[model samples]
Target: MHVRHWENSGGNIWDKYTVKMFPQEYRDIDKIYEQALLVSNYADNAIALAEKLEKAILSLEEQPYRGAERKYGFYAFKGYRQLTVENYIIIYEVFENEKVVAVVTVKYGKSEF
Candidate 1:
């Protein structure tokens, strides 16, 4: 992954972290997309939802701390954070020393899983 660096108006360099998704996260997202297609029976809607989720996840590359600390359920004591995209909650953790944001999981907000 390529880390992006940008300059602010004041000529300050802003470092963008690299974003990585766990192998399981990829499988989970694929399953979510498949289930969405099955439930809605609409390819377009499923595609749109997948794209939106991807966009939100990618945004972490530039703003890794944008999501609030996970203080409620599952992984709450593990120092994980969460970013919500539509009905899905993206769980992630930031490794500031390595300048990387790792996505741990993605779960439907309404589901207990």
Candidate 2:
């Protein structure tokens, strides 16, 4: 079966900051925002780091044996997968039925969780 992809329009507090200030910090943030919008225009578009984290998570989920190391609590969700992105980690579970990927949370560093 072909892998399906879906985008969500959810944003956290930190993500809000990224959205507000990234335009001032770096011009690349605009590009990042555009790329993310490709998934969902209304979705919470994050900075470069967040985009990187999402790409990594997607890669790992498609092939759970790639660079991602299986961690505990992964089984809590049917297709749970986690990955690190610039000191921050993103946890998400893949759902094959709806062709969607749901992000559970994005937190700073592994210790934050």
Candidate 3:
């Protein structure tokens, strides 16, 4: 397969897929950070964790299908997928037409939307 986005030392990644985060996803990440702060009273650790979470999501640029289909069938879009990072689930969808993997939302793994 040919790659077109996200580069590493080995080679380029993505099947021309560009990863992007939706506004709701940003808010979800902020909520997680805020919750962490409430528990530990520190922003450093929370920030680091959030960064790592972001990296995990970016890693999906080339493997947009790495996540499984929405099992509950509650999602509006049929192409919805879920990627788990620690206790959080990153909801994303691959748009073949736009060559984009748009992160729809992020939520605690065990929680329901």
Candidate 4:
């Protein structure tokens, strides 16, 4: 699976935190980055996750769950879903025909609405 982030996703993630913690947060962000890398060697693990997530979404739509769930503080639009991965939540969308997932945000845990 290949993951793709929206232009401002990374910035949105960082913006939720204090500027000073950016350095330490980078260290934390590295873990997910590694998890994504382990899944696929591609330079952008976020893309990998997006692709993986798209597959899951397709499965979900095909199977038809009781309902679709949204995480707290997630803003909704026509074609996307956002969720937390540990402390940070990445916003993403699934494109059915293309089987593509686009990540729109990569924010920290302490973010508030």
Separate clash counts for every candidate: 0, 1, 0, 8
**Location of the lowest summed lDDT over 10 successive residues in candidate 2:** 15-24
lDDT of 2 by residue, 1-111 (tens): 223343335643222211111122233334445555685565564455456764665554344333343355543434556656665555555444443444555544545
Best by lDDT: 1
Q: Pick the TM-score winner.
A: 1
Give candidate 3 misplaced runs (Cα > 4 Å): 1-6, 13-16
- Ten residues in sequence with the least summed lDDT for candidate 1: 4-13
User: lDDT order of candidates, best first?
Assistant: 1, 3, 2, 4
Provide the lDDT at 10 for model 2. 62
* lDDT tens digits, residue span 48-88, model 3: 87997888787877677888888773664577998888888
Cα lDDT of model 4 by residue, 1-113, tens digit: 23322233333432221111124334445665676677677766666555544343333233322123334565554455655444455444555445344344455557663
- Tally clashing residue pairs in candidate 4: 8
Model with the higher lDDT, candidate 1 or 3: 1
Q: Which stretches of candidate 4 lie over 4 Å from their true place?
A: 1-74
> Which model is ahead, 2 or 3, in terms of lDDT?
3
lDDT of 4 at 34: 75
lDDT on C-alpha atoms for all candidate structures: 0.83, 0.46, 0.78, 0.44
Q: Can you rank all candidates by TM-score, best first?
A: 1, 3, 2, 4
